[model samples]
Target: MTCPLIQKDLANACALETVKKIVAEIGDGIFCVLVDESGDCSNKEHMVVVVRFIDGRGFVVERFIRIVHVPNISATGLKKALETLLSGLGLCISKIRGQGYDGASNMRGHLGCLKTLIKKREPQAYYVHCFAHQPLLALVSIARNHEDVDWFFCEINRLVTFIRSFNKRQDLLCKKQVSHFADLIENELMETGTWLNQELSIARANDTLWGSYFRILTRLVWLFTPIVELLEDLNSD
Candidate 1:
């Protein structure tokens, strides 16, 4: 336990065992693959591969199979990296029933794209743009075309940043929420139960995720009174 190398070896062993179990569950069944590449904090490109298939209980399951370093993001480079990863895992590319990738030019381009290259090998591997990105793309388009929506988002961003800049302000917000909830509970305006009226904090929005935007807006509405009180106190100070 005191040795770092030993710890790393143990972790690797656990990971390999988990992958082996997942492969046994798959049992030569067709699976859909989702592949995406992004740069790490050190500016190194890495590609993640996930496999989706139905389990013995007939429930849809998705497992992260590997994250391989890809020095190149070109169509051919990505395809080669993918093939190597799948083959190493003892998986056949021909068994792929679906391919999911983000709407990147190198991925879904009309000619000489990753999808095109994969199709040449396995015609049944139908390509679908990642659904998680659809709402993000829609929100981005709306923000560009509409002035009011874009301005609202900007103001929200400023408000969240201002509040989160100071540790004292965050503590004040949490204290105010506690007091407000107490009042509601005493007056029977709110019900108390297991997992009810959980504590909430401000969520920062992300440029690539629509769910983060929704969360911040929802928290803003839920904690409106405490937020307003916080701003008023700051103004007085």
Candidate 2:
């Protein structure tokens, strides 16, 4: 029997086919790349590549090209990886208008960084400090310099850690959210359903970095009542 997991060759073929359609639609148009690298739980390094461009209809679009696994994380290695990726996507490096990476010293190095290397290859490609990371850097500076704000965040983070610590609590929380929604539906107090037959409108804006796990706890606190009620219902069930 065939295994349930996707075979590498087939998956790569399918991914290439999708990227082929995206490039065909983009068609020699100028575009910018947003690149970021992260380490996975398995200790493997992966790079996420996203492209932003204007389509034929004058509408802006952003699409993920792929997450590539690189054997090495050096500047030279990453630059080579990018070259191979663009070639595989059937896109010319000269058509690249911009590049973005995090505020890391290695990435933004004046001499041999990926930004400098790409610029050498295509002079028109401007290197941008990832706009989303700007606010994050600001916040980091604030947290370090400020005492009260840091303490407040630390307390909230502890609370969030407690909430997410156990699977039993998580399941109970989901149950409560469901029960609360049902209660609202039963009382005819809220419309719980809607249908969209046409295209969905998406906001075109520079998405900034939003703070991390703290938002999860903030949301949980806001929805605490319904969550409590749902958990009670689950217990009685």
Candidate 3:
């Protein structure tokens, strides 16, 4: 049961059955596609494909199609990969009424992009920049335009980098957290209960995704005193 090969086989079978059902559900219907590509932890580029359409019950449904490993992420290469995937699933490119992708040059470029290529093949396959990423992009733009906001984020990044730079510093942080929590419990400032006093680590803000700034700010507020003490201890040493 723990064999890697057997596990892979089982996963593949499950994916196949799931995709078959999705394709059946999308049968003879005009659908929209959403595509996104990113590098995995192993640094391999994989593109995710999802099909969205209204079902017989008149409810909109979105289904995962497959993840395709693409060695080349050029617009032409991605278009070919998408074409082959849809063909294998017996889905026609002409039936694609919409294309949703990020604003990456290779994806939404005016010329020689996945959007343009698809539009050329099927003129009705209109493209739209994905709505999910709009808030993050807007926030980043506003930060750049506002000097104070940008500076605050920069200082936060520097603080996280300095603390996470050395193993000894991290160890000191952990010790400070334990001591602080113990004091809180002793003073009845914090409750003593199961799962109440879990340890926390500082989170660094990520530029590409939403809520990352909020996470890092929340963590900083929670551990502000410990972080300041750690910095002072390092300065004295």
Candidate 4:
């Protein structure tokens, strides 16, 4: 009673049915998407798309669904890649509630293409600029605009480079630590770079403007004077 074509069709139908069951179980909820594109050393741009949502069990989870390699960054290419990804995965665009990007012009531009294409299809897709990245951008702008502030960053980099370059300098830094030197540095500097947008602003404003800068600068001056003096002596010689 089973025709081969009918049997094959039934198998495919069951597969889709299973997918539908899962989606239904997941129910209605807002889903957040993060998309980024980057070029490798080979100059191939790869787009990665991830989804975050409350799953059937009511736990928030982020799942990476696709990493697609694209040859170019044109609007047409990006649109096609997205459409193909959604169609292949049986994902509905209407279900998308939030979109996030790293402020790439192509991703957020009013007419630069990608945003235009997406808005045409899913007008309700709300876009949010990555807040962490925005802070870094603000810092970069402040640094570039002020000369003294720029000098501060250069100095900080020089100091960091000196310590990182030689074991002796690193040991000296470790010895001067009130607690574990590594822990101190990690606590103060590791997450600092994530706020790159405010870096220049923090550097330029006078010591009186932000009292915290003095504390940070004092630490740098204490830890780095020996290395700086040595370098100066070498230059003079």
Global lDDT of each candidate = 0.90, 0.74, 0.90, 0.64
Q: How well is each residue in 54-161 modelled by candidate 3, as lDDT tens digits?
A: 998999988989999999899998999999999999999899999999988899987899999999999999988898888888879988789998898889999999
**Of models 2 and 4, which has the larger lDDT?**
2
| Residue range 1-237, candidate 2, lDDT tens digits | 265465776887888888988899889789998888878999998888999899999999988999999888878888888889988888888899999998555577877888988898899999889877888777666775789966765665564454467666666666666666577668986565565111111111122334443455556564667556644665698
Q: What TM-scores do the predictions have?
A: 0.63, 0.59, 0.66, 0.49
Query: What C-alpha lDDT, on a 0 to 100 scale, does residue 106 get in candidate 3?
Result: 95
Model 4 Cα lDDT, one tens digit per residue, 61-105: 776666789877776787788778766666676777777776566
Model 1 per-residue lDDT at 189: 92
- List the pairs of residues colliding in candidate 3: none
RMSD of each: 9.0, 10.9, 6.0, 13.4
Candidate 3, which segments miss by more than 4 Å at Cα?
Answer: 151-207, 211-237
Error of 2 at 141 (Å): 3.2
**Alpha-carbon runs more than 4 Å astray in model 1:** 148-237
- In candidate 4, which residue ranges exceed 4 Å CA deviation? 1-30, 141-147, 151-237
Over 1-237, each residue of candidate 1 has an lDDT whose tens digit, in order, gives 879999999999999999988888887899999999989999999999999999999999999987899999999999999999888888888899999998788888889999999999999999988988887887788785798988898899999999899899899999999988899899999999999999998867875677788899999998998899989988999
